[model samples]
Target chain A: MRIGVVHETAAGERRVALIPQEVDGLRKAGHEVLVETGAGVAAGFPDAAYAERGAVIASATDVLGAEVVLFVRAPGSDPTLADALLAWLRPGQVTVGLADPLGAPAAAAALATAGITSFALDLLPRITRAQAMDVLSSQATLAGYKAALLAASRLNKIFPMLTTAAGTLPPARALVIGAGVAGLQAIATCKRLGAVVSAYDVRPAAREQAESVGATFVDLGLDAADAETTGGYAAALGEDFYRRQREALGKVVAASDIVITTAQVQGVRAPILVTAEMVHAMAPGSVVVDLAAAQGGNCELSEPDTEVDVDGVTLLAPTNLPATVPAHASRLYAKNLTNFLKLLIVDGAVRLDLDDPIIADTLVTHDGEVVAPRVRERLGLA
Target chain B: MRIGVVHETAAGERRVALIPQEVDGLRKAGHEVLVETGAGVAAGFPDAAYAERGAVIASATDVLGAEVVLFVRAPGSDPTLADALLAWLRPGQVTVGLADPLGAPAAAAALATAGITSFALDLLPRITRAQAMDVLSSQATLAGYKAALLAASRLNKIFPMLTTAAGTLPPARALVIGAGVAGLQAIATCKRLGAVVSAYDVRPAAREQAESVGATFVDLGLDAADAETTGGYAAALGEDFYRRQREALGKVVAASDIVITTAQVQGVRAPILVTAEMVHAMAPGSVVVDLAAAQGGNCELSEPDTEVDVDGVTLLAPTNLPATVPAHASRLYAKNLTNFLKLLIVDGAVRLDLDDPIIADTLVTHDGEVVAPRVRERLGLA
Candidate 1:
């Protein structure tokens, strides 16, 4: 089996699917690795670094012709890359990436027409056995950790209070909305930075996880019945419910020195939890990190990928926080991808075992069709 | 006595001399407080905010006309504002600020020619009774704390090591050069954020202070006899000593993930601790924060007041870090200024007692003469 890694072409995307450190693992598993020239440069890995680790430095065309190709981000959501990616790939080839098929299933359609087998890594089910291969969790961890740091950097006051000879400084208060992977990581990182942390989530059980990570859980006095879906994500509660939730969260937002909103609804437009009034009420030096900026933002005033000064408050709507720490992001992503790729390597060849739930769920397209049930159903194909 | 505060006109200076919370104390002491319109706006205190605290909002001209005027930054050292400051202020009016006269004695000369009583807060003596009035220590505390946060935020990896489901991440290593107030604070802050911190200083007594606040002191195995001056600052050891110090420190710097330089020699240029070659030897994605940037950066490649990428390392030369966090910086500065201002108020009037060492040391000019001995000596007026 031959594995290929290429340079990412998306704006603000610095992570590569594979790093040179993990190339030895692929070779040990009886696979040849081909890395395009300067593929990992932006992620802090040079061509010489990859070549030193037994990875062949090749041109983009040669690497694309390999049996298996990998990417951290794919053209599934970017319509501009659809034609270019399709033209570069061929039949019987395998592509593995967080293709973002949920947002743009049309990308899967293009892959199907090209008669190639494509696995959308984002579709990997949340299961114990599949934990190692979970690209979403790995990337979300980086995003959440960076989100807390981003808030701390933008804040005017220190996160941790200290009693000095001059006077005592009170620790900054941080409030995290959403108790998912990103939210929990944010809570942990903020705690590590010595902030007085409080987190909120509609799912009642999320309180345990938040509390376990040294964050006080804020429970709004509202019945959030069946707030969590079977997929272990927050269920959409409609506009009326969100409006009332925002109203209830106004006081919390105003009291907090830093607010981090990770209220992403997976494939849907992110819910606006922090309203304009809420943001305006925050202190002049308060900071807000909206992790859902790329998904239309969890705050009303957030402009995706830009930092705005609302009065004196700083609102950072960074679209790709993982890119900001490309070194660690690439490292974790490479490990997750290597874990997934290891599963498909059966006796020095690619194995498409549809019986396994991980394989069946992540396989977005195969044999000239949108074979994944979810993508097929999304495309209205029987 | 009437005290007035106007907006600071210095580049990137946002801190104010007084805050609204401390204005009530001045009023209770039988003094009138005047704040120029928008004086505290950048410091997170609006005109309405000051007005609510019993401060009268006045024009810049009226504020300067008051019996006593306060500033976080003065026209001192800035020739552009010398003539304007001299013209705006009339004789007999008292001006107090961090005049920066130690570094630029010529600035004190301009104030003396105008026949105004000027007090340079930076010249305040390091006595027990004057601890509350030490603006340099107060402002440096903020600068050091912010320096650590800036380094963490710019870093490519998290400061803390965590055993996550993905894998364990190692904590980042931080090195602090010069164990002054700013350096010790940086060490404490980096340690609080979970970075493994090490520090170095030429003064032997500085080791105890650095170690007391969670830092491993680095000794270069060189004879550092007579390293401390009478004023408790590092003695100017000349180029030969600095060359040997940099040579010994090269290995230590290359091993650290983040390096913070606070090696300022008061009233003189900062000694370069990390050279371009040393920076080049460090791992990619490392960060260096030069806190002594305004004094001519401790890193050879550092550009004061800007962020630069040297090879692959991020060198942040932030000037006036206290100004960047104007809200708390103003609060702390106000507390220190108010403490000193209380000493000058007697029988509802400003008292200038030459007997008080605190007053005598800080008073740069009085009665049409450069009165402070240090300023006079530096200006060749002795």
Candidate 2:
């Protein structure tokens, strides 16, 4: 099979679908790989590197001629590129990457009209065997890690403690609102930086995890045992429960020098943890990193992807922490892509076996039809 | 000291510092509690409830004249009310609530200079003794739970599986990137909703937690032995480790239909987990709940507090998921505040011994100065 890697045309994106090293892996797997000129340059993987790795460097036009066209962000992300790709696409050729399919089902239909097989990675099923292929988890780890770094850098005080010639500097206190991956990482990172960390979670089991992370668990004694749904996610609490919980947390919010909140229930708006009142309670020069700011903010004063000085506290809602460290983020994403390729490509041929749980589950559009039931429902296709 | 509860003046904020029922505990502890008219109306508690609970309803001016002022948020949050309170504040009075001390340290200092002692709920320490008083953790629990609900609500597919009259709906696959409070809630909620859940964390110890919540642990095969620091938080992994981690996770992301990424490193940017390429690899109509959207987003296409469709995947970054259910959120916050109040108000008198670890650690400012060392350092006050 021949795979072509195109330079992403998405705005603010510098990552390539296939870096030179990944190309080598493809060659080792007995597949031919082609790279558009300068696809990997921005990410520090030059076109020459691809050639050295047994990849053929080609123009975008030549690259798209292959059996499979890969990209970090597909043409759907860039309408101008989408038009060009639709015109250039050959029958039976496969297109893969983030294609914005739901937002532009018309584009998916267009691909179908052109007789092209397109795979939208965003629809991958969550399963054990597919763990290695999960790009979301891989990238999330980076985002979680980066959020802590951004907070620490912008924080007024050092995260860790120091006992130099001066008086002993007590460890900075850090409060992580959510005990999710990012919150956990924040706790871990803060602890590493010698900050005293505490965390909270709605699920009963999170208490133990918080304690294990050396963070004292803050339990708001709400009858939340029933708050957990069978699928292991938190069921939305009643208004009564939330009122009680917030009252219990008020003190903690006021005491911490740095509060890193990563609280969100699935599919809902990000909860406003740091109310304007809470912000007022914090000392001057306190910093709050609201990971949920985009959703509306854990802090009431938080503005998405922006930093605001509320009273004396600095509330930062960074929108793209992962992009700040593109090199590592891209590398991780590329590896996820490689692993995914390994699953669908067997013996150098792309196989779409509906019987395979992994394949059947992740397949949304197949043979020019939206086959996934959920997707069909969302698109009102049924 | 007679404690008085004031209604919040911030627009759209309905939580009261103390619910009428909560005042019973304070009264039982031998403290006289006063409630401002309509303080608990939005939280479903009426002034009549306070009268029933042996509490006196008073005007805002009357409440501010009490020896101690209690509120959901501090004066900075409701400048108009705070100004009124300041006018009536006598020297040596005490004020407690979410003060936003760091954001509004000057305000706190102003109160202190006026001979009023202030305690910021945001400053509560993460310690065992202070756990009950930890307002941040309690509210975070709600935020985490709320995030999962938001994701599930907006998701195209049902969270759990069902053997229907037509056929068996395979269990929805949910991947929670972070294992913090919100991530755990998402996992628990997803599991309860009948989805197969898998979770990832940088800290090796989080595996036990993930499993406890019925989530399969997704290990990326990295040497994470050093991932945790002494304080039990995640240590920042070197770039090399992050590279390998991303590679391992890419495969997992490619298989999940619902990827709720809660990976946030404190004070930094949210890591980008779902790249445009990764999203493309997913099946169409997938949903990505980027809880870290405010910090930049775990998904490449996520816009802060908005929903973006990438290749048929819905990237929802709700900034204020909790606010969506403000009634409940407010209730939880009230409870947290009540618990914190119990810690400081002993026998109708405000205590500021500073000998207690919880109190000492949480004190951000005192006597018109930023007494907290961390706050001092943040302000460059040596």
TM-score of chain B of each: 0.96, 0.82
Model 2 chain A weakest lDDT span, ten residues long? A160-169
Task: List TM-score per model, in order.
Answer: 0.97, 0.48
The prediction achieving the highest DockQ against the true structure is 1
Please tell me which predicted candidate would have the highest lDDT against the true structure. 1
List candidate 1 stretches off by more than 4 Å.
A77-80, B77-80
Model 2 lDDT, residue A21, Cα: 62
Record all residue pairs in model 1 with backbone atoms less than 3 Å apart, i.e. clashing.
none
lDDT of each structure? 0.87, 0.68
lDDT of 1 by residue, B65-120 (tens): 99999988876734356777789899898888888887878878888888889898
Q: What level of docking quality does candidate 2 show?
A: incorrect
True-vs-predicted CA distance for residue A13, candidate 1, Å:
1.8
Could you list the CA RMSD of all candidates, in the order they appear? 1.6, 17.1
